[model samples]
Target: MTSERFDAVIVGAGFAGIGAAIQFKRMGIDDFVILDREDDLGGTWYVNHYPGLAVDVPTTTYSYFFEPNPNWSRLFATGDEIKQYCDDVADKYDVRRHIRFGVTVEGARWDDDAKLWRVGLADGTTLSARYLVTATGFLSQPRMPEIPGITEFAGRVIHTTAWDDSYDPGGERIAVIGTGATAVQLIPELAKTAGELTVYQRTPIWVAPKLDVRISERTKRVFARMPWTQRIIRAITDNIYETMINVGVVHYRVPFFRRLNISAMDLCKINQFIQVRDKDLRRRLTPDYDIGCKRPTFSNSYFRTFTKPHVHLQSDGIDHVTADGIVNTDGTKTVIDTLVLATGFDLWEANFPAIEVIGRDGRNLGKWWRENRFQAYQGVSMPSFPNYLSLASPYAFLGLNFFNTMEYQMRLMDRLFGELRHRGATTFEVTEQANTAYLDRMTELLGDSLWTLGNCASSRSYYFNPHGEPSLLRPMSTQDAITEASTFPLSDYSFV
Candidate 1:
């Protein structure tokens, strides 16, 4: 294979990847490639095209800082709307042409002698780059339920991650396993058309009403003409949302704040909660975990779907798949027409492809992670992975607007590049000692939170390790997390 090269290579053309490409253009680094497994540039929005799907975060606040769109039709835009927004950004910034779709990177090995990454593409294409940016969103890969006979099922089984246009839901008895975020959004959509929707909810979700309102045409035109007004609105809205997260999430991580946080919606009838005739269903749907323990969902019509006589929330844990459908642990077997795995994606390797990264001394990132837990300085770059940054790596997930997190990450990356140029540095990597200290600080801080040693039971998740500790997000507010990431002095890295 002939060797080719670029100044930078960005993985996964979602919000992060597209944002990075646009920033690279501003930095005068034009030779860069945006790689994704999908055939389009929307990333997560492209694949997760289920019905009734929309942004949990308010639309005005969940956008790029560089180019904020003041034309959102609703406060909470649908999945298609979000995808179109991403597409619009890609076109506006001229980043779409630079992206190569259906190209999965098999491995990325950093050559210590050459100070470049040896990237192996799935199509047997090998390329080298001076820098690497992993922009794969956290929810990229689908997590299929570990059930026996799932593969042996004679019927069609579709994961929400792999939703195709041809897979019709109308007139089909669908069994959607796992009532997490994906399941919550999909149930309302599927319930509308499916013959009978069997929602196999393992655990109930603490769902709040999605407060979506249509933006008036007059209001939109005004915001367009006076964009600074929109900016002010965005800023204020963002502050309010951040305050909520601080109260709900950051509060849960603290002792005294825990009780005061999660009970805000306990008695409120905000967005109109539906009165279910069945008392048993109401109790089964209620969640016991602190509001921030698991990811919270928002839907206008999720709970009300049970009112549809065809739709049923089966609380009984699915024991096994029989010939046609599933058998519950409670000995109830219902033969479904189809199986839809709305179970969420694996946060770690699925979102960030582990196979590609081969760092110093031919160290595979996956192997390294297996031996040692994922430790990073503010969840951006690992030690020895210089000239490389992750868009949504560990400790960088923002439950609010993911776009905010991407913007913050892109801003820091711009700063890193500026530092490199100032110091005349050809490469910038995290020092081993610096990474160790950062990791120690993060872990020690997390140990103090209610998330790690709180009343919540241990569940192996993106948030926890085998030791059952919170590692997905830093145990602090978004402002605090940014401050923590900024603590690593750029002067520590050496120039060429």
Candidate 2:
């Protein structure tokens, strides 16, 4: 309905997008606008309003490059609070007016000759830009289990992703499925109110206590006085994150090291003692796999919620959903008044939504991914697509806060942009051979990582590849990634 043009257009206004916008502004680059699918900012935060929805990572590290929040209240803020934080960030940076909300990008591709990207919106609108950043985020897609008769359920049903205030599960028999981070948080909140809560867990999850507390007034005053001190603290604590990556992937190569880490996890079962009063229930809460195998859950209240008298646990596969309730493989039918699905988002190769993106030589994304299995050189640029960058690219997961990673990525892209502009290049694209070389090296490095062992029998995690290996997440140390990111050679790309 409206036609406008800009030097660049960014997608999503969440952590990655906000950081990108802020960095772009600081770089003295103008003529850029951020577009979000929601009516407001906060990509995942705006959509997912499930009770007890909170950030698992520490609050100190989860912020921007230019500014930090003066009032973060809690160590790990809830979804609402985080959403408000994002809103506050946009407002603080004065990028809120530049943001175009309630629009979803349907298609985006390189225009080789024109040297601009033609991006189509959900409402049949189009805009062309010199640069395009797909900050659509990793957790945007929600995956509900494909069980028969899912639609025939008679009672109210809701996914944790789309939780709203109107829906009421209070004092009702409710089914909470999946025990990941979101489920871990929501289950505790639900146990306090729901008269009956039956959890259907397919696989066990490893959980750690959220060494979390409110931001102390004294500490806030210190940070407020000297903010660089906060950044210094973040730098020192960053090794903890890098160390976890080592424990996640490297410990598998050494059985003795793996044993030590597992023993350490076993020793941290003080949380189980505090949560589950019953021995059997406590055992059910504990995981059999190595710790940090799955995305390590941080919660002070998760296991404790199961100790409630009304809560029950069912650790079997669901057979099908009947009109009245769910039937498990063990022939147990859960007669529930309401069903709450915590099943994670669709997280596989097939889950990437259909989008029309024709790059050089009319190379489409679907075919590229289908043939090459969703490969990206450093998860930023692909073989055919030119002058495009994906935020939270593949293997971009940092064990700690990823905002810093996103900021680093934005910096890398700025460098690439600098090179492209100064060289008088029309378009820059990566060579196929370089892409293959990078992926080959990455796969070989992940052979002995925990993903290999952690993805073994009884594991149905999304990180595992088709060969049951955990190559999706890079096994290399974060130092290598940062080094590679900082020194991204132009030799990998071609200029038109």
The most accurate candidate by lDDT is: 1
On residues 140-213, what C-alpha lDDT tens digit does candidate 2 reach at each position?
87887888888899988899888868866679899987887788888888888898999988777777767877
Candidate 1 ranges beyond 4 A from true positions: 253-256, 265-274, 458-461, 481-488
Q: List runs of model 2 lying over 4 Å from the truth.
A: 268-270, 277-279, 349-354, 453-455, 465-471
lDDT of each: 0.76, 0.74
lDDT of 1: 0.76
lDDT for residue 124 in candidate 1, whole number 0-100:
88
* Candidate 1: tens digits of C-alpha lDDT, residues 1-496: 5278989898889988998899899889999988888899888889887766778888888888767787889988888888898999999999999999888888788978888887888888888899998887778767878997777777888888777668788999889898887787888888888998898887777777766799999989988899998899888888887777666565555655666564654732232246455778887887665556667778778888888899988987878897699888898888888898888878765644444687777666666665777776657877767677876666677656787677667667777788888878898877787777877887786665556545457223456654465677765666665564455477555556
Evaluate residue 275 in candidate 1 and report its C-alpha lDDT on the 0 to 100 scale.
48
Which ten-residue region of model 1 has the weakest summed lDDT? 264-273
